[model samples]
Every structure is written in structure tokens, then in C-alpha cells.
Target: MGTTYLTARLNGGEARYKLPGGHPLTGRSTPDLELTDDGRLADHLHGGRALLLDLTDDPELRALAAGYADRVDTLTADCPSRPELAAVLVRPDGFTAWAADVGAQALTSTAGLAEAPEKWFGVPAGAVTPG
Candidate 1:
């Protein structure tokens, strides 16, 4: 569901949708940070250069991701299957820029998405030091 939304926004092409069919527990027993039988979700994140976070091990990170995700309704969700993993992305300013599983690929990978952050976001230029 989320990944579909992102593909449309980022790719600007027809969305690809897939439904996972199997036992309900297929994703329940899997690790949060790791991809489940549904590989598309993980693939989208990796392809987008987004960070995947497991909050169960780190409450602080979870809380932070939760807060940021809340700000952007499009970026957050309650992962019933993987409650421990709180996926997140850090903006150049050290704030949670965006948070989502497979759905956020577009926002994270889209060209000029990072223009708002003068420090970093768009094209990757060599490091700039203080004058």
C-alpha cells in the first residue's frame, strides 16, 4: 500500500502493486529490520537509499521515528507484524526527515527532494568545509 504510493510520486510512472499470499504468520516470526517474504518492501527501501530502523532494541530511535512519522502522516504506520522495526530517515539537520517502510521510496529517492536542506539532499557534491 505504502510502496505503491511512493512509486507513483517518485517514479512518476505506473505503480506496481503486489499482494502477498501465504500464512498470516509468515511475517510475524521474521525479524523487524530484515525483509519478510514480501521482498518488494525491502527492495524499495534499499533502492531509495532510506534507512531501516528496529525500534524494539532502541526505544530512543523508535520514539524519534514515531515523532517524525507523526508529523508527516504519509510517512508513518503501525507495523502489526514488525512492531520492533521503526524505519526512519534523518535529514541533513539531524531531524527525522521521513519515515515509512516500502512506501517512502519516492520521497527519499526523488530528484530535488532534498533541495530544502541546503546542507545536503540533491546531487551529491564533494564535502564543503567551513570558510
Candidate 2:
């Protein structure tokens, strides 16, 4: 079994059982998700938060995600790519700090989601660099 499976088993497969509340990206490494705008794979130093956006629909959400450019390294995936989430803010440790389900109302604006990045990652525009 994989390390994650083993770890999850050890932790009772529940968020409350885990010391820090966050989930792994699963099925893909953080590097694989760090695709450039041209769709080429590239290395993304694990420093800033990663904002995963769904590119299948919702133009408004896409624009709202841009507001976090200073604090996050945004990445887009095709629709249905991640069925459970419409957007995710991943910490430098490759753990999801925050995730939003697929709903327009679930993530109305960047304001509602700003605290997670600041609390887990750092200040906006990288004012407080992640350790």
C-alpha cells in the first residue's frame, strides 16, 4: 500500500484524528499540477500556496481567483478534472489548506477564502513569506 493509505489508516481516515487538518492532493504529485500557461510541465518550488481552479466553466470564479495572484500560484484544470472541488488552496507542504466544492455560491468572492491562505500560507502579496 502507498504511504498515504498507510498514514490514513493509522489516523483513522478522518480529519479530526489528524493533528493538522489537511488532505493530500492524491493521484498526482504537486509538481505535475504546476503546469505553465502553455500546458507544459514545470517545477514549482514549494513556497507559495497553489490555487487550483476549474477551467471547465464559471468565468466569474476564474476572475476572482486572479485577485490572489500575489499570495498564490494559480493553476487551472479542465472541467471534471477534480470532481470534488471547484478550487483549492494548497500550502507549501503540498497539503490542501482549503478547498471549495463545485458551486458558484460556495465561493462567491476571494474575501471569504482569503483567511485560509493568510493563516496557512502567508500575508497577501507575500508580505509574510512562508517559512
Candidate 3:
């Protein structure tokens, strides 16, 4: 079992859990693929908050993900011959919290994109609370 699994089992920390064939990117660690635009991915993977990556250079995806900028480290990269993944919300531990793979699946994933951050990291940065 992976360290996250063992730690979660032994020390009672957060566990990634089995995803049961969701997006291939979901529930997995971020790939250490080189960034075409520059910089190493590992350098930013643990940047305090979750890291939201726009890997395919999609403008809409970047704009959509930017909404969580205050809660995540939104970044763009051109990963050559990349996987089907277009965007991903990765936790500080380097595991994926949420992901939107390319092609048709992106549609389904994007629909729930708005909910991913809040699900993993609590409310939005500027969300209003009940009086």
C-alpha cells in the first residue's frame, strides 16, 4: 500500500481511498511531467494550498479554474503529448483532489468542477456566511 494509505490507516490521517474507475487522473498522484512553458511541476505541487493545473492551454479551463485562485495555486503548463487530462485540482500532498480529463469526459468533469474545491478545501475564498 502507498504511504498515504498506510498513514491514513495507522495514524488516522486523510486517505485518498479507492476511486473505482473514475477519471484515471482522480485519486492518483500528479505526474512529474515536464512543463513546456517552464519550471518543474514538483516545485509547485506542494505550494501551501491545493494546486490547480491548466495543462492543455485551454482558455475557458484556465478562466474557470481561476475562480479558486485564492484557495488554490492556479497555473498553466504545456505538457507535451499529455494524457487526456485537461485540468486537475491536486492536494498539497501531491494527490489529485479532482480532475477533468480531455475529450467528452471533460464535459462531465467540468460540470462538477465548481464543487470540487469546496468539497476538499471547505468554502470558497470569499463566500458569504450566514448572519
Candidate 4:
């Protein structure tokens, strides 16, 4: 699944939450991504382990970025101005589980952490303990 789709799914679920936005944009197109930052949508991928991909200069990655940008609203948050600087959280099955602009928080709450591990890391519900 794509970042937009995954974000929508997460928002629909009980675990939906937002973080205060003040994250700095990084990667090859930092300047472009920063232009779209409005600080409304809180970055959910804050502190948890994440998979970061640098697609700034890759054509294939750029194509994937376009697909994600077009469906930004569908994912439940403002899309980064440049999708190439975006980072997507992936489930063990290789499905996109969440999308966050670069430098944004990945996980900030127990619910967010639980959802990520269960949905993305393939960890069972019982296996995760809230902090």
C-alpha cells in the first residue's frame, strides 16, 4: 500500500493521533519539502524505529513520490511538497503502514507505538507493553 492509503487507514482506526509539528526537513530536496510544511498535521513517526529511504535522485523513487503526492489528502494529512523527501513506515509484509514528512516524529504515544509494532513489525498485540 502507498503512504496516502496507509495514513488513511491509520486515521480510521482507533489508534489515530497527531503530534505538534516543528520538524526540520532533510534529504536531497529539503528546500522543497519545507515549502509545504504547514505545522497542522503532527508527525506520528517520531521516535520509533523507522525505515528511511533516500529517493531524492532516483527516477523510480521520484515516480513513486508522484503517486504518493497525488493522493496526499486521501492519506489524511497534508502531503509534503516533495514526496522524495518523505519517509514511509513499512510493515513486515512490505506494505506501507504510515507516512511522515522527513524529520517528523515517528511514534509519540503508546497507542501509536502499539499500532506500529503490531501492524508493521508483525508483533502480536499481547507482545507489546505500553510504557
For lDDT, the strongest prediction is: 3
- Candidate 2's C-alpha runs over 4 A off are 1-49, 55-70, 79-81, 104-111, 126-131
Writing each residue's lDDT as its tens digit, candidate 4 over 1-103 gives 5887888667652232333222332111112223233442223233333332332323433333232332221122234555533443332222344434434
The residue-by-residue lDDT of candidate 1 on 26-125, one tens digit each, is 2122233334443434433433333334322344444433423422212233445665334544332223333333333333334212332222243233
Model 2, TM vs. native:
0.49
Which has the better lDDT: candidate 2, or candidate 4? 2
**lDDT value, candidate 3, whole model:** 0.68
Candidate 2's residue-wise lDDT over 1-131, tens digit each? 69988897686553331223233432123323433353532344345546544434556555655656766676566433346555655555555555556653546444245456556445655255547
The candidate, 1 or 2, that scores higher on TM-score is: 2
Using TM-score as the measure, name the better of candidate 2 and candidate 3.
3
TM-score against native, each model? 0.22, 0.49, 0.70, 0.24
Candidate 1 Cα outliers beyond 4 Å, as residue runs: 1-34, 37-40, 43-52, 71-131
Ranked by TM-score from best down, the candidates are: 3, 2, 4, 1
Which residue pairs come into collision in candidate 3? 84-102
Candidate lDDT values, in order = 0.35, 0.50, 0.68, 0.34
Please give the lDDT score at residue 32 for candidate 3: 72
